[model samples]
Target: DAGITQSPRHKVTETGTPVTLRCHQTENHRYMYWYRQDPGHGLRLIHYSYGVKDTDKGEVSDGYSVSRSKTEDFLLTLESATSSQTSVYFCAISEGLAGGTQYFGPGTRLLVL
Candidate 1:
């Protein structure tokens, strides 16, 4: 990755193992999204939640699950992650709708070996 984030920002994990990444925001934005950025794919949405406990699957939702038990926190879990799932994951928060301006957090680079 770009090496802009902190220590846990760059993670190296193995395949078939469960991985959970958290995005916590103190702003309490209404819309939160989890997106993965790859070389060719650019950024693909994995999941997004509008409110606490109200979530919707995105285009690349397969093999991924999300939970939003609180408005300030969003969790993205990969059940038995595979090599194909290795990418830079990002969490974005927006006050308006989906197309509105979004503030993105530092990416978490996950390398599944």
Candidate 2:
């Protein structure tokens, strides 16, 4: 995905600890999203933003939270890291319409030990 960067903010964290990952896009797309990938499960949506400060939880949003104070940044935070949350995280960007093409950033692997 162009103009997208998924930060591996933390490679490892202890269980019960809080973890925060970041995704940044320079394409000025109006829609940003977060997804997690596991072995058996495909990429599952976590949260998404349609604009600055306009965000909604996705399928796997129970133990996670998101904040998009700026259009260029989308922050995903795990309230408390757990082994179950260990997986590769991705950030995607979409053009004007969310139904349009989407550009995905590099996956950031987060390991909760």
Give all candidates' CA lDDT scores.
0.87, 0.91
Off by over 4 Å in 1: 1-7
Lowest-sum lDDT 10-residue window in model 2: 1-10
Candidate 2, 22-107: lDDT as tens digits: 99999989999999999989999999999999999888999999999999999999989999999999999998786668899988
TM for every model, in the order presented, reads 0.92, 0.95
- Residue 51 shift from truth in candidate 1, angstroms: 0.0
RMSD of 2: 1.2
lDDT of 2: 0.91
Whose lDDT is greatest here? 2
Ten-residue region with minimum lDDT total, candidate 1: 1-10
Count backbone clashes in candidate 1. Answer: 0
